[model samples]
Target: MKLQLLSDLHLETEAFEPEPAPGADLLVLAGDIDATWQGLERFAGWPVPVLFVPGNHEFDGRAVEHVVPALRGLCTRLGIRLLHRESWLFDAADGQRVRFLGAVRWSDFDVFGARERERSMRAAGYFMRLMASTQHGQPFDADAVRREGLACRAWLEAALAEPAAGRWQQTVVVTHFAPSLKSADPRFGRQPGTASFCNADDDLIPHTDVWLHGHLHCRHDYLVARAGRKPTRVLSQARGLVDKGEAEGLDPGKLIEL
Candidate 1:
């Protein structure tokens, strides 16, 4: 299967009109295509099957309680599959099957170390200020985000362990947040603020074949070692803030073969 990967189009401020690339078996939008949810309509009736995973931006200014239900309804109406803590199977042209597990995977603020969680929390206040999402009839707080992130991690761990998911020809994990610190930009390496952008999901690398994510507004394509298994390929194809042309290593026509 040749899957075209794209993310972080941020169509809220940037202009983009994309069609499924020729010969692509699937089009995967890793998230942040738009926060307002209107940009997603552009993919309606796309030539190939389109799978989307909502990024943090999708909830900004919207109540956390309402953001997902609204997206789910829109996706159902548009024929797009929105995956979050969800699984979807794709039948490849070669008669192979690929299974995808997706989530926004919010940062746990434990990227540095368990001991430094407090420091990471202190350094990152931007999410609360900007997300502006409400939960439990109150503003969503860091603790809530942290709990949700960990819950995603737990769900993924259990999902990957399922025999049914493992029976596919290949397994792929998708998220809006970086799976490992290695996917982070080197310039911000080890910074407390960087904790908000990625996760300490090194433990999960050995459990899956491929991982796709978008959050840092950059790009990455690297292989991570997996014990007694094929090396896991980590990729990000985010377009970032195109108006500023800051998204590095972006390949809009990039395709991954499974």
Candidate 2:
């Protein structure tokens, strides 16, 4: 199936403009659809099926409960599925079976030997507290880092397990953040202390065919090998097909065949 991917669209009604490629079978909004409902309304008129996910900005510094339903309803009206730590299996128009796993995943680098265990632990603790604070209606806390990371791992385990029955399964993992430092922005300029793409390790499962992410605006194309077998394609459409120095808007007008 052909898919057009876009992400990190921090739209404020007036500034949001997406002119996606024409005639795409599917459009995937990787995350951060927008900080307010304005962005959702802007995309309401899109012609094809859309799959959207929540990003850090989508939360608008609020709890998930507060914003999810609104976005979900908007997506429902537009025939889009808002995936968050969720999975879906369906057949394409040509009868090709496709499975999608979406998560605002946490970086798992330390466990994967991609980063220092101490650093991973520190980030984990911070993520856990963040999640907790959001749940309790309290201000942001660094401790939620671990909670978010562990939750993402748990969600992915379940999401990836379902397609094991098929010999020729196509799995796409969509997230707001990249899984490793290999694809991180070069602005850090080789600093050891700089966090990787997702600030953690990424474990690409055997069935994964593509990994789509955003958050690092300056990054564009990347590839990674998982398990020394099938090649996994990693793509970010922060500015679509526009080159790094271009003055184009965030919504790049490219259509990707998935």
Candidate 3:
């Protein structure tokens, strides 16, 4: 099936213009879907099935009580499937099958960097608190960085091990973070790779396929070797609304028949 993948559309409701483009079957919004939940309505009204995941922007690192409910409502209204630490199998146009395992990966400093150790620690704590801040913390330590990794890893492993695994013509991994190590470009600037950004998890190595993510707006496209030891395409389409110049480098509103 023809699918359109986009991310980081820090939504501007007044000027939002996303055409489904003719022949597009499914739409995948990797993350940073919008600047706020207010944009959800318009996104939901799109005439197609959308699969989305939350990006760091979607989280205030406070409580999901705000975003989760709104997202669920939007999904219900728009017929979109929001996956997080979950998997979904989709049928493409050519009878091919694709599975999406979604997650907002934690920063992997071991590979990315140790520069923002203090900030990473704080952010990690905030994330953990947000995860567990609900209930009497019934879920217990929802904010733990280790737990987040485990959850995402568990879901991916299970999805890859499905009994019908070999039945899929090809698989696509939809995540909020980059999955390949090859995307690691430490050659860039002042303190290149100093930001502790772009996470790459060990769990990702095995399920390598197409990693559709949107965290780095400048770093952009990358391809890495994984699983079948083949090139796994990675795309991060996070240009903000004002990026008219950058838009020229992208082919939006087109269906990628993979």
Candidate 4:
């Protein structure tokens, strides 16, 4: 199957010209497409199947509990699938069946180690503070964000271990947060307190054939070698815009064959 990958459109501020590949089987929007729910309509008339995963910006100035359900409802009405701790199967053109497992995958502050976590909480005032002020009339504290991350991790682990996971000819894992440190920008990963919220633990790296993620505004496509399993390809296609409304000129969009 040929799948086109795009992310971090931020359409509220930047303009996007969708260049869909001819005969593309699917289009995956990694995250941060827009801040408000109305921005989803930009993708309305596409011909191929659409899959989406929400990013932190989706909940900006809105309650997470409310925005999530509203987005899901809108997705259902539009025939788009919004994945969160969920799985779906697609029949490929080559007569092979492919499975997709996905989640928003929040940051647990564990990627930077214990000492960094302590310093980040002290210096950066905990990662949740980044979103606390954005939430509408609701208390989005550190504890709540931490608990949500824990739940996401638990769900992903359990979902990967299901017997059905081994039935697919190929498996792809999609997330809105960076799952491997290698996929993150070197400059951001070296920062003091900002790195923790930019990545996830590498525990799920071995189970997927292709790891599709978008959080760090950089694109990565490389084989991650593992112990006993085949190398997994990590792809992040984020067309990040600068202050003057121009692309960062990095990896913008990618077409992957599975």
Off by over 4 Å in 1: 164-166
For each candidate, what is the lDDT?
Answer: 0.86, 0.65, 0.61, 0.75
Each model's RMSD to truth, in Å?
1.5, 4.3, 4.7, 2.5
lDDT of 3 by residue, 1-258 (tens): 777888767673325566686788788888776646566566666777788887756664335445556776777777778887777888766677877677766444334445554554554454445444432334323234434545665677677666554766666777766554544434433232323345545445545567777655533565666644667666666554454443445566756666
> TM per model?
0.95, 0.79, 0.74, 0.89
Selected candidate, larger TM-score, 2 vs 3: 2
- Give the winner by TM-score: 1
How many backbone overlaps does candidate 4 show? Answer: 0
Clashing pairs in 1: none
The residue-level lDDT of candidate 3 at 72 comes to: 66
Q: In terms of TM-score, how similar is model 3 to the real structure?
A: 0.74
- The order of the candidates by TM-score, greatest first, is 1, 4, 2, 3
Candidate 2 residues 1-258, lDDT tens each? 778888866674225477656767778888766666567665666777778877766665577556667777778987778888887775667666778888877444344354464564455454445434364565543334445656887887777766457743588888887666666666554343333235443565444788888866654666666666667787788642233442254446666666
Q: Is candidate 1 or candidate 4 better by lDDT?
A: 1
lDDT of 1 by residue, 1-258 (tens): 888989889899887777678889999999999888899989998988999999988998878878788999999999999999999888888898899999999889998889999888877677778888888688777777888899999999998888863568888999999999998876668788888889999898778889999888778889998767778999988887755665655668888876
**How many clashes (backbone atoms < 3 Å, residues ≥3 apart in a chain or on different chains) does model 2 have?**
16
Cα distance off (Å), candidate 4, residue 204: 1.4
For candidate 2, give the lDDT of residue 152.
Answer: 82
The best candidate by lDDT is 1
Candidate 4: the clashing residue pairs are none
